[model samples]
Target: MNEPCSRLAGVAVHLPETTMTTAELEDAVEARSPGVRIPRGVLERASGVRRRHIAAPHELPSDLAVAASREVLDDAGVRPAELDLIIYAGVLGDTVEPATAHVVAAGLGAACPVFDVRNACNGFANAIDIADALIARGGHRRVLITCGELLSAGIPWRIRSTEEFFAAGPHYTFSDAGAALLMEAGPAAGDGPAGGVLATRFSAESAAWALAALPVTGLSSDPDGAPLGIGRFDYDSLRFAAAFNDLDLEVLHKPLVEAGLRWDDFAAVCVHQAALPYLRAFCDRAGIPHDRTVVTIAEHGNVATASLPLQLAEAVRGGRVRRGDLVALVGLGSGIGAGIVIARW
Candidate 1:
């Protein structure tokens, strides 16, 4: 088989120090709605999450990104000056105008071209695709990809229904986290136990975009008091189950077929840690074994784009994956975007 030019050199993760247990989250939600009744144990079992970490009140996404990036660079033995590009792939940004990547680049003391990629949950995988192209075309020799998710900011605190649903399970499981991966040019550039990108396939279902979206119409600011608005987080569990199942099956088919491999070819699958139910449904539809799939959503909630790399770093750190192992990185998120990349570890 023909080998790819770019590879993943190293990976690092940064987790918040503050841990919030399922019961605590339930209490917080119940406080918002005194009449709401939610079972803490039910929420825990449904989400498969025991506790999650959140950033300190003053911490920002960039802070976590800088720490994670430094760790990755240190592990890769690559200096900041050597980096050619830096990409921040996450839903949360330091600001709306100046790209989060610019802030992260400045913090890392990296003098490289920087930008942000917003594919929602698929941001990391999309960033990897871009980095691979840059390395292959010689536009960049080394690229640093970072993602920081401040999911806490997205929580809908005012809505009684939303509060109840979140407290019920999936909402409490989200933890703040940041992750970084260093990608370098050349087929033999990877120094870690995992090899770089082997092949990648991407597919989009724009028609289903409305199925999972943060609709602007749902937001409204209170004129009398502190800024108060509703952020549309319309994720119908039933709709998601149908959409993601179809999307995953469609996306994985060509990638696996093009690579001339089957489900058993990969030793492990590192996919977006969106939620427990979504992950399990995708695996069932894709025919991927649960044991081969990595689950961090219970502990980290949905780190948006950072989920995949965080899972990969955990696999590497735990010694579950080794060199020359065929690993599949799958991403599924808003825009109903789904993509699969086969990497040799």
Candidate 2:
């Protein structure tokens, strides 16, 4: 007998109502940090992000996750009680302990085993791989994977100097959003309308992890009355770009090789929502046509861990992807890690 595999049953997303255009963000930067100059169009040009949603101060990651989770369950025609497992797959969570999945599960009235799977930006793809394994090995039928990003929360509003602001530049491209996916055990490969995951591979470059990092600093009260604590992100953009291209060339085709397929076999490819230039470069290096790729970074910015699923959902809604078409899901996260999943839609 063939191994049981999971097929994507449904996908749903939620975005905050507040939008900050690139121009507006620059303006805000000027107002918040006087004397620091972010030239017109520089932010958008650097990140390829036109605008991004900002979560309300009171909105938590769990709230966004629940919103998307409810919609996905409805889309899949499944009840909360029907879920055998719930995995919160996001880079940020509601708190430091007890697992963010617990909060999301409770919000959705989900009575199931709950946990979290975090892999920076590759979270959604990683969760899918885990769910597929459980369904195949443990006989779990239905699983829910949800990710909510409060990316704006990490922005340090009060920068002490131009260098500090410059270090945070890459973060301007991040947006607040949530996405969820419902997967269930399905017939073997080529047996259903919702196709099974044909192959998935995850790789990491630990030595290069420090190339991108989000570190929290300033725990003690400051005499200047600034916030007691703040989150700061740093990255070597040039190094990351070069490393990303090299890694793609090395492993982007592993899944295809493992599955004995070719680029022509996929109808669409959903790469992580990073800068447009990086996406274009990756596609070019992989020999994938521009028309075969889906990009959300320009419009939504990078939604962090929700990026992959959000991209996939957007492509489906836009008709860029269709049932019976094979698509590739590629994820590149700050962990300096990459994950690829090739599936038939």
Q: Best TM-score goes to which candidate?
A: 2
Off by over 4 Å in 2: 160-164, 191-194, 216-231
Model 2: per-residue Cα lDDT over 239-328, one tens digit each? 877677667455677667777887777777888877887788778877777877777888898898888788789888888777878888
Residue pairs of candidate 1 with colliding backbone atoms: 7-196, 8-196, 174-301, 175-300, 195-345, 323-345, 324-345
lDDT score, candidate 1:
0.78
lDDT of each: 0.78, 0.83
How many backbone clashes does every candidate have?
7, 0
Model 1 Cα lDDT, one tens digit per residue, 1-345: 233467778889999888777778777766887566655577777767677788988889998899899999998889999999999998777876699999999998888889999887888899999999888776788999998887776654444664557533444555788899988875542434445787788888888887766654423454555453445466666676577666646667877887678877777798777668767876877788899988887766777778889888989888887776778898888778889878876
Q: Give the TM-score of candidate 2.
A: 0.92
| Candidate number with greatest lDDT | 2
Specify the poorest-scoring 10-residue window by lDDT in model 1: 217-226
Per-prediction TM-score = 0.88, 0.92
